[model samples]
Target: MRPVRLSVVTAAAAVTALAAVTGCAEKGDAKGGHGAIAVTAKDDSCEVSAEEFPAGHVQLDIENKGSKVTEVYILFPDDRIVTERENIGPGTRASLTAEVKAGDYAIVCKPGMTGDGIRRQVKATGGTVAKRSPEMDEAVAEYRTYVQQQADETLPKVKVFTDAVRAGDIEAAKKAYADSRIGWERTEPVAESFGDIDPKVDLREDGVADLEPGQEWSGWHRLEKALWQDGKLGPEATAFADTLDKDLADWVKRVGTAEITPTSMANGAKELLDEVATGKVTGEEERYSHTDLVDFKANVEGAQKSYELLKPVAVKNDAALVAELDKQFAALNALLDKYRADKSTYVFTSYDKVAEPQRKELSDGVNALAEPLSKLAATVVK
Candidate 1:
C-alpha cells in the first residue's frame, strides 16, 4: 500500500523543527568537566553535533520537537542504554542521563524520522562507568545444539497432520494440525531469535476451486471452510478435505527437508527485510500479500520454536543473557502487534487513501526491530 504525499510533507516539517532544537552541544567546565550533548529529530533524520564525549557522567537533553514518536539509544561496544519517549507530539523535549566510560558509542533514533539518527565513534576521556563483558562462546554453542533437537522432534508432526488429512480422517487431521500449531507456537519465543522462516505454507483460504486441475491451494483456512459448512461437512466435503490434507503433507515434507541454521536464518531475514523495505519505499507490488500475513505469523512461530530450544541453554550459563532474550522476545511481539494493527487499517482499502507518513512509520518500526532481531539470531545458540 502507498501512503499519500501530504503526510510525507507534514513529517518533513516536523523533522525540521526537531533538528533545529537538538543541534547544539556546549563544552563547559561543569562538575565533571564533561559537555552537554543535544540530539534532534528533523527532516526524517537525527542530527547530533559533537556526538563524541569524554569518559565521564554525561547528560543528554534529547528534544523530539517532531510530529511523530521517537526513541534514543546509546550503544556501547557490548551493551546499550536506551530511553524512549512515546508520541512526543510536536514541539516537545525529553531528557536522558548516562555515565559512559571511554569507548566507542553510537547514538541512534527511530526509523525514517531524520538525520543519520546515529552518532558514532564517541570517545570518553574520563568516567567510572562499568564496561560490558563479552558473552561466552560456549553458551552460544550449547543453544544451537538444543535448537536442532527441537526441530527434529516437532517438524515431523506437521507431516502427521497432513497424512491424516490425506487419509480422509477429518477429526484426526484437525487434532494433529492443532497439536502441530501448538508446538510451533510454543517454540516461537526462540524461533524469533533466528529470524524469518516459515514452517509451511497454509492453503486454508483458497478453497477447492483448482483441486481437480492439480493447482496448489494457498492457505489452511480454505480447507477449513470447505469442511465446515454450517458447522458440519457433507459427503462431498470429505474428498475436498482429503485433497487439502495431501497438499499440506507435501508442504510439511518439503519444509522438513530444507536446511535451517543460524546463518541461513540471518541471510533469509536480511533478504525479507530488504524486500519489505523496498515494497514500502517504492510502493511496488509486494512479493507477499496480505493473504500471506498468516504465513509470516507462522514464520515468527518458527522463531519461537528456536527460542524454546535455546532457553534452557541460556539459563544454565547466564541468567542475564536469558533475561535479555526475554526482552527481545517481548519487543518482537510488540512489533508484531503494531504491524497487525496498521495492516488491518489498510485491509480492503485502496492504497491511495492511506497516508504516506503512516506507511513510512510502519516500515521504520519494522526495520527498527529487524536489526536487533537479526543480531539475536546470530548470537543465539542451541
Candidate 2:
C-alpha cells in the first residue's frame, strides 16, 4: 500500500533471507529506472518529451500546466491502461512508473481529472531492463489470466440469480444471491473501473461517495431490499435483477482489459480483509440475507489467489515475511472452512447465527491476514 509516507518507500531490494532456502539479498538496492520520462500536461493537450524510447523501468514525470487537476495514462493497444498517475493538481508535478515491453501505446492526459483527454501515440524500441525475474513475470501472467477467468465465471452466476428472481422464487433467488457475488467481489477492482456500470451493478446503498443526488438506487442492493426487507420478489424486483444481470454481463466482457499491477493486487487482498473486518464481521454487508460468510469466504479466496501468484516473488525478496503471510492466510481460510455445513451451508449462514466469540474469531482472523498482506505490496512492487 502507498503509505502515509511517500517517496521514502522506494522499492528497495530486501536485504534479509531465510536460512538454507532462497539465500540472502542486499538492501538499499535501487528499483526500476535509470531515467525519467518528461511529460507536460496543458489545457487540452499532452506532450511527451520523447516520442520513442527504450522499453523498461520508466517513470513518467508529469508537470501539469493546466488550471485543473490532471492525470496521465499509458494505454496499450490490448486495452490495458497499463499505468497512470492521478490528481496532479495545477502547476504541480507527480510521477508514476511502469515496467513495459517494446510496443506502441497511447499516452492520454486527462485535465480536470474527468474525461479521457488528449491522446498521442508513443513507441518503445529496446528490451526491458527492469530487475524482475522470469518467475515473477510468469506468476503475474497466471494471476492476470485468473482474474479474467473470475470475470468470466461471475457472469453465468448472475444469470442464475436473475433467473430465480424472474421466476418469482424468493427462496431460490436468495440461495443464488450469495454464490453469484463471490466471483464479482473477487475481481471488484476491475469492475470498479467501468465508471457508470460499477455503481449500477454492485454499489452498496450506503456507499455513495460518487452518487448523484436524486439518482435512484438499483443493482444488488436494490434486489436485496426486495428479497430481504420486502420479503417478496415482485415485478419491480425481477426487473432490477434483469438490469443487474445485464450490467454484470457487460462487466464480464469489459473487465479482461483492466490494468492490475502486483502492488494493486497485494493491496486489493488487504483491502478485501479490511472489508471483511469493517463490514462482514459487523453484519453490515448482506444486511438482509445475512450471508456475510459467503462474501467473507470468497474474499479470502480472492486474496489467497493474489498471494499465491506473487508467492515466489515475495519469497525471493523476503522469505520469512512471505512465510508469515502464507500462515496467516491459511489460518483465516481454515477458520472459515471449519464452519461449513455441506455445499449449501457455508460457515455461518447468517451473522445472527454467530456467537460473540465466533464473531471475534472471524475478526481476529481477518486482522492476521491483513497485516502481512498489506506488507506484501512494498516487498514486491517497484
Candidate maximizing TM-score: 2
Minimal lDDT window, size 10, model 2 = 1-10
Error of 2 at 97 (Å): 11
Residue-level lDDT tens digits of model 2 in 73-147: 665543233444555678777555455667677678877755446788888777754455787668667878887
Best by lDDT: 2
Decoy 1 TM-score against native: 0.33
Candidate 2 structure, TM-score to reference = 0.66
Q: Tell me the spans in candidate 2 whose CA falls farther than 4 Å from its real position.
A: 1-132, 208-210, 343-347
The clash numbers for all candidates, in the given order, read 48, 1
lDDT tens per residue, model 1, 1-382: 1110001001111100000011112333222223567667543666765655666446566666456655555543332222222223345565444444455555666533222244444555554633322333333354445445554565567667556655667677655544444333323323322111221133223223313244444333434444333334455545555554454444334333332333333323333343344443333422222222333344444554445454554465456655765675566556555545464431222234446785566466555544444443323332
